[model samples]
Target: MKEKLIQRYSASERINHWIVAVCFVLLAVSGLAFFYPAFFWLTGIFGTPQLARILHPFIGVVMFLGFFIQFFRYWHHNILNREDVKWMKSVKEVLKGNEVGDIGRYNGGQKGMFWVMTLCLLALIGSGIIAWRPYFAIHFPIPVIRIALLVHSASAVALIASIIVHVYAALWVKGTIRAMVEGVVTHAWAKKHHPKWYREMTSKK
Candidate 1:
């Protein structure tokens, strides 16, 4: 018999995720090129250095808007609760390949990552607008623009680090990537990793 599967993400949700992810990669490369002379060669990824400089802020805007939509769609599922506390406390065991707590649609770490990404995107957008030149930057004082640049850079670094963890966790946890890619998971995967969610899904049938 074929394995039973449960839907985890809709097609649009998966498309939105990949859009944000691609924009992030492009922005990271261009931003790094502009930030460090040693990595100036990275700008070639966008055709030319001048073009990269021009496209970086625009890509940042796209990424921010994409994530903004995602924030609203999944925020409710990511809310922290007693179960999250239990999950966090037993994170070590979870890392050892044991499921912990009555895991819901998301675990403690996933919830925390969601919020962290939200804050970083917020910071990135706000700072990015302030530092955008030939436009908003001229309206702000030099010192203010400098501070905004600092915040933008810091937020970018934090976001990059958090995304690395997110990617790693997706790869480390069996069947996790399928949720975003194919938009479904085997029943066994759902039951083993997210028993509470599994019950909720099954009960609805």
Candidate 2:
């Protein structure tokens, strides 16, 4: 028999997600290159240091907009509840291939990550505008611009770390990547990891 599958992400959602993801990678590489002398070579990703400097902020805007759409669409699902609290408390058990609480559309870790990413993006975009030279930077005092750069750097670091964990979790979970790539998940995978969400999806049919 063919493996049963359930849709997790729609085609539009997958496209939107990839847009943010690709832009994030470009911005992270360019930002790191600008921030650290050791990683300056990373600027080559955008062709030249000057090019990277020019493109990073533009790409950041694009990424922020893309994620903004994602935020509104999924924020409801990520809202922390009693069950999420229970899941967080039993994170050890979750890592041990067991889930705690009635897992919904997202697990506790994923929900936490979503909020972190949301805040980080907000900070990044605000600070980026203040520090963006020849554009918004000219409107700010030098000290204010300096402060914005600091905030932007801090937020970028936090976002990068969050993405690392996000990527690791996606890879570690047996069928998680398929939910994004193929826009579906195996029935068994859903039943094991998110039985509540699985039931909700199936009940409509």
Candidate 3:
């Protein structure tokens, strides 16, 4: 039998997602190496410590730009609503292999993660510029630079933690990874997890 599929993402969207994902992993590893004495060995990811230091900020800019594209593209569908609130309250059922609420293209949890990613990215990029090398930091005073460093570190930690959860959830939910990789989801998968969205899609066809 032919497998029924529904489009979940486009080629361009998947490409942009991967660009951000790759840059994020690179940045996370290098950033950790720079932040911790023990993890300094991770500098091998970008060649040497000096190389990692130089490339980390540049990679960060790339990741930020890539995610900015994703942000505008899907932010509308990600808006939270009453259904999202109901989904949140019934999250236990969701974790137990059941889905609740009139879920749309994104679930409540996904929507929350979207906003978290946005805020973290905004903070990281803004503070990163203030603490950046001889180019931008020199424009700011020592105290200001110190604060920016702290803000940058805090936001980095938040983003890293959130991404860890994001990856884990994707793995835990079968077909979730396929949506991002193949830009499609099986009709059954969509119907089961996002019945309202499934109905909308089917109704349009």
Candidates' C-alpha lDDT? 0.95, 0.95, 0.94
How well is each residue in 23-133 modelled by candidate 1, as lDDT tens digits? 999988888899899999999999999999888999999999999999999999999999899989999999998988998999999999999999999999999999999
Off by over 4 Å in 3: none
Query: Looking at model 2, how many pairs of residues clash?
Result: 0
Candidate 2 Cα misplacement greater than 4 A, ranges: none
**Per-residue alpha-carbon lDDT of model 2 for 1-205, expressed as tens digits?**
9999999999999999999999999999999999999999999999999999999999999999999999999999998888889999999999998888988889899999999999999999999999998899999999999999999999999999999999999999999999999999999999888889999999989
After TM-score superposition, what is the CA distance of residue 146 in candidate 3 from its true location, in Å? Answer: 0.7
Per-residue C-alpha lDDT of model 3 across residues 15-97, encoded as one tens digit per residue: 99999999999999999998999999999998889999999999999999999999999999999999999999999999999
Model 1 scores worst on lDDT over the 10 consecutive residues at 27-36
Off by over 4 Å in 1: none
What's the CA RMSD of model 2 in angstroms? 0.7
